[model samples]
Target chain A: MAAVLPPQAAPHEFLRARTRWHPLEIVFWLSTLLPFVVVPEYLQLASQIAIAALFAISLDLILGYAGIVSIGHAAYFGLGAYTAGILSKHGIGEPVVLLVLGAIVAGVVGYASSFIIARFRHLALIMITLGICLMFYEAANLAGWLTGGADGLQGIKIGPLAGTFKFDLYGKTAYSYSLIVLFLCFLLARRLTHSPFGLSLRGIRENAVRMPAIGAPSDAHIRKVYTIAAAIAGIAGAVLAQTTSTVSLEVLGFQRSADVLVMLIMGGAGKLYGGILGSIVYMVARDQFSGINPQYWYFWIGLMMVLVVMYLPNGLLGGLEKLTARWRRSPT
Target chain B: MKAFSLCLGGLLAAMFAASGALAQQAVKLGLILPYSGQFADTATQMDNAIKLYVKQHGDSAGGRKIEIIRKDSGGIAPDVAKRLAQELVVRDRVDVLTGLILTPNALAVGDVSAEAKKFTVIMNAATSIITTKSPYMARTSVTTPMLNESLGMWAAKTGVKRVFTMVSDFGPAHDAEEGFIRAFKEAGGQVVGSVRFPVANPDFAAFVQRAKDSNPDGIYAWVPGGVQPAAIGKALSERGIDTKKFRVMGQGELTSDEALQSLGENALGIITVFHYDHNLGNKLNRAFVQAYNADYKRNPDLFSIGGWDGMHLIYEVLKKTGGKTDGEAMIGAAKGMKWESPRGPMMIDPQTRDVVQDVYIRRVERVGGKLVNVDFDKVRNVKDPVKARMK
Candidate 1:
């Protein structure tokens, strides 16, 4: 009965658009299967890349879609890692149970921290998140009896997946386990980003002040996304713990958070597939370049990052998307 | 996305091409060490030591020519070490694995070695428990506790009644401090006070001040790596604490060749204990040091000795097993084997698979205007009590 449409019509449009499957999505999922057939030896590397990608995607959920810039994302990751490690060390070595437990613990912490984080904007949020991560880092370091101090949480024996398919030295089981987790998480994230709630998050990200005028509880929406993102991050960490069977102080380190941030940016933030693509690129490049000259690998990595940031403002995926769209539009 | 995938595929192809050059008949020894960053200097020296040994031995152990493939673990990140260890095992198909400076990296690699059923020889990591993590693992290097106990006992015996202890706040530091304290207490020496400083602390004046305030006869210190020991020596000298008046005793790295270079006269007369000394006055050590000095234009350090001994251990085992790369056979050959190393005679304890070697107590002295460790006392067949006590 409305004569004219409101300014924010995309949330309604998103519902209809979500039903059709994107060809790119199918292609993306299918490509992951290639590693199993093509290079079975690099399964461990592939698994690590998947874990890092998941972490980057989690960061993207908050930073890219919700407009919450976090430099301390490792807080959730470390929490999840320690949770999985401690549980497995105590004999609860089932992968699913560990992932769920890790996610719950990290999600709870994220939800609690979200209340405080959602109130702040920009630099204050960054500082608070960094402070929280630092506190956890120190706690892990000081709790030597439980966490093994600086020596790392060792003696973790992760059992078989579904009581079958043992974690082989070749990492076939771990790769499949992480790939399936990543795929499921990606599907849920895809649904959320296309839903009304996700549209509201994007609305909040674009213009927070205007979002309030449109009757959206901006803080609550951001908080929900942040908690969801943190749960995903925890899952990534749990996967890492299960695959590696050990967690060191590096999980809680500032470097981990920074690396994820870099990965998210390089892959093109905002889009669902950007983080995974970016992780594949960054981790693979690092692996190759580090083998060439381990001492000066950072110099090469820095140069590549600079070139990407300078040339592609939206990131690698964004630039590629632009190129493909232009090609499709051109009279070829 | 397709373009990116194409690029990645190309890169992977290139990497595979580069890696496929190794011959199937050669015995590939995979060395994973930090080639850059904080531990790079020591790691490079260790690499050089291994290379020197191979070059001197005509590059053949038993009947097989050794081919070394190096992988850098970067730093202490266990995940990186674990991934690289897997790659070396599955992809590279390395016959033997060795090298890791950090304890965590060694532990991670040890786990990989155990899981993959590969023989891994540890050269530098001093964590006592690394030996127990994998049955396929053998440590040619000494543990922190084994290196420190001798100094502690010698200090107690040589009129150091009450001593103040200091160590950097980390795992190996804790091991060193605890080992020293235990032996000192057992030898009836009182621990006056102890303080742990943060790693890479720029200034040790406060710690030195605390030691002075403790009014102890000696100060037993365990500082972390990389010029910190030299800085501590400088700080002690600046504070005017004469070694003769109040003894400053610690592990060998406290006044090692690198520390002595920066320490100079300040480190002179300071007594410390270690498993390896450049001036051990033995035929093997003298030749090794001469060759090492001629090759690197620098003196040999603890890490260098570890790597040298590691090569010797591997060669000896290979000879015994007739160049067999079978993990069980290699491990069996290495067990309870004793050899005269550049440092001293060392034996692999069958129970622990860790080295039982002679620890030398050395005093820093200036010989011909060059500072070096002079062996004043020695403890023969010293074993790691921590490992002995492990169930």
Candidate 2:
């Protein structure tokens, strides 16, 4: 099979035949390694990036891959946080179990709502999702007996991971825990994207009518993906709750959902890896800008957003990728 | 068969009579609070305090069982207060209603409660104007204007000359800034400048810079919540602004140990005005602080204390009324009623229905690795006759 192929094909064949590393691939791996050694602060920033990446990735799956626009993704995030909090308050200390239960609850709620949500498009979808989020916020307030109400769920003691791994104050445990969860989720997302199921989702995104005609189960596929994305978003929320140990009603606010959407679009949707990069840049920019001018930081962020949307339409990563492609074509 | 029918009739009549007696013996209390959204923390604190009171009192006040029902206001959103009040009255049919965290929320609920002829208790909100506008509303919490005016008076008395004020765009904060400026100016102090920022402002550098450039004798701020003090203090410190150069005064948990840890020593020497502080040397205050710290591992802020006191005050009135749920009876009982509070003797004013309480002027100090109230002085016993600047 190798002999019959061209020289380029031969190289591909050898790489497919054996695990041979590309120079670019090696450099990418090394760059990840370099951060741990040279820029330790980046690791702390990277942990936040990972959590935000998870959030954006969840949104991307629903928005980019499933062709669904959710303006209330924070509903699931907030729900997950409250669930973890409520559960912990009731003496359930296992972090993994709490995380799982939180995700599952959000997923179930998402699945139930997907029927109503899947029928709508654009503005209607946005409004309906926002309505649902507001409903949750109101309900959380009303159900003060369970939710601890506006005072928030305080004095939450997350004892340990599986009753063993204690959470430390300096964010060491939190960073590692978030990193591990993010890595696993990333791998899972990669596998899903490459799978036949993900390709079916892509087909639905391209042409919903065509996919249904071709026996692709478009509505069911969309619903399933939406539910999965919500579950992932719930994981992000659970992680946040574990890290902060205090979940406020602001988690379900429209602003948080908007932030995730912005991050997804800013990172270049559909590529999957863009979410991580976007979250990192966005958070770093926010931190730096706020540090520079606390009161006028929003102005700088708003300005940057305008520039990104107007000039780099596909987002920072997409623009860089395009630049890299051009550079390669022109031999630098 | 006739004898059997008569016995059945007698039994049915007895059951009905028993239920009626039980219903008559119980007093129903309603609490409307923002149990969700941003104000949830305050609501929960109120809820917990009420619950603790109820548990201690055995759900009975003055020989009658007490039935407490609470509804969430959501926030100071349009129509939410009315809806919550309607639910409390129409569904739960509570006799006495209480708990409003924001000024607008208190006003909204106060109207509804008055219309329904229910005794309303304004808990955690510091809207001084509400009591003046509505005779039915009674506030257990300190008023924003009163607190601000006190700060201004204190500053003036301490010989502060030119003052710059910064505050959130909210009504309470706006009122605080305005009231302080007015009082400070009245006390022969010159107003340098004033700026209002949005509540969700994450950065305070511009405001700090503006204040610095103005070169005021003191800077007065009215920013609340846990985040504001830290953010403002850190920014001020980073800008090399000294607290000694200006008198920083406001309502916040920012000067607390938890906030100081995040803000560092920048919070030190900051003067703050409030009705209650953990350092107050009253029996109730000492017990409350000790119990709360033992329970929550954190010092109770004014919000928590206010919540606890609001519940206690309501309970005291209910107990005095002999389980009468009538609005008139409860109102009469509440007026001129004195209670031993965390801030000492608290009396409900007969006319305005506002609490006549002592206000404290505290300077923030780092004690045992925590920012706490040190060098506190009881500046004045604020009474209702002072007349809140509402109109």
lDDT of 1 by residue, A1-332 (tens): 01234557664664765645778778888999889889988999999999998898899899989889899999999999999999999999899999999999999999999999889888998899899998999889878889888889987979999997777777888899999999889888988887888889889888887898889999889889999999999999999999988799889989899999999999999887889989999999999998887667888999999999999999999899879879877977
Whole-model lDDT values for every prediction = 0.87, 0.72
Model 1 scores a TM of 0.91
Query: Candidate 2, B248: how far from true, in Å?
Result: 2.2
Q: How would you encode candidate 2's per-residue C-alpha lDDT over A246-265 as one tens digit per residue? A: 56566777878988888888
The candidate 1 chain B region of ten consecutive residues with least summed lDDT is B15-24
Q: How many residue pairs clash in each candidate?
A: 0, 12
Give stretches of model 1 more than 4 Å off: A1-10, B1-24, B200-206, B226-240, B261-265
Instruction: Give interface RMSD, every candidate, in order.
Output: 1.4, 19.1
The sequence of per-residue lDDT tens digits that candidate 1 reaches over residues B101-151 is 788888888888887678889998998888888999998888988878777
TM-score of every prediction relative to native: 0.91, 0.53
Residue B2 deviation, candidate 2, in Å?
A: 42
